[model samples]
Target: MSTKKISIGSKPTAKPVQPSADEWVEHRGNGNGPEPMKRLTIDIPESLHRTIKAQCAMRGTKIADEVRELLLQKYVKS
Candidate 1:
């Protein structure tokens, strides 16, 4: 009688290569795609910061999203 043997365990495969910066921009720059986000830094009173944090926690939303909504409402007119 003859028997065949098969390999049981094998090494993991390598991860796929990441895209280059230029490729990333080209892939994401389509007109219908979302606009790239920009970072903003500001200094505010500690109390105001605390209030904003608390409000966001109570509303279950991020401070950044809340601020963006407020800014759009205040400055963007239809």
Candidate 2:
């Protein structure tokens, strides 16, 4: 019996594909009157995420809506 050698090396990665700004806006708009909303992402603890999700479900609300309201209250000041 002969032993075979194994080669392990980093694989070449393909560049991430991103949509053009016009494409992104068109896709997001979908004829919805040109909403100018921007997307954001945040990292949170898993437990906190679960709690917020559960509370929103119970209140028949959306996580985005809750976050948007909190942001508006804090910064918009109107």
Candidate 3:
């Protein structure tokens, strides 16, 4: 067996690709910018969940947006 020494050299690293502000917001929910959002998970009956989903789809709205509007109307006093 022949003994050989391997040369160790530093390898160049490519910079990570970062999403622009709009792209970030489009993909990930805005969590770091102004008006940051927090996630809320809940359990609901399958039928009710389906109904809400269908209604939101028919109305061209998002379930989260609907829930947020309902919650704001219920709790936030004008």
Candidate 4:
């Protein structure tokens, strides 16, 4: 049996893809109006995540929708 040599070197780095301002806005816009939805990334404890998932399952809603509602209720003015 012939043994093959494996390359254990680091791979070349790729340039990051950056979105243009107009493209970014258009992509994120809701299309109803100028309401753009921004993506948010957050870290939460496993327990909290489980709780959110359970609540969403019970309500038959999405975690994002539930989180958005909660945020609006707490932050947005009536």
For every candidate structure, what is the RMSD over all alpha carbons to the true structure, in angstroms? 7.8, 12.5, 8.5, 12.0
| Model 2 lDDT tens row, 1-78 | 999999998987988999999889678767759657889999999999999999999999999999999999999966
Residue 53, model 1, lDDT: 100
For candidate 4, lDDT tens digit of each residue in 12-57? 7997989999988677665678765688889999999999899889
Ranking of predictions according to lDDT = 2, 1, 3, 4
Q: What is the lDDT of residue 63 in candidate 2?
A: 100
In order, what lDDT does every prediction score? 0.91, 0.92, 0.90, 0.88
Candidate 3 per-residue lDDT over residues 1-78, each given as its tens digit: 999999888887988988799888686754576765689999999999999999999999999999999999999999
lDDT of 1 by residue, 25-60 (tens): 877766787887889898999999999999999999
Q: Tell me the deviation in Å of residue 35 in model 2.
A: 4.6
- Residue 43 CA displacement from its true place in model 2, Å: 0.3
TM-score attained by model 4 = 0.56
* Candidate 1 Cα RMSD (Å): 7.8
Clashes of 4: 0
Which number leads on TM-score? 1
Deviation of model 2 at 33, angstroms? 4.8
Q: Candidates 1 and 4: which is better by TM-score?
A: 1
TM-scores of the candidates in the order shown: 0.60, 0.57, 0.56, 0.56
**Model 4 misplaced regions, further than 4 Å:** 1-34
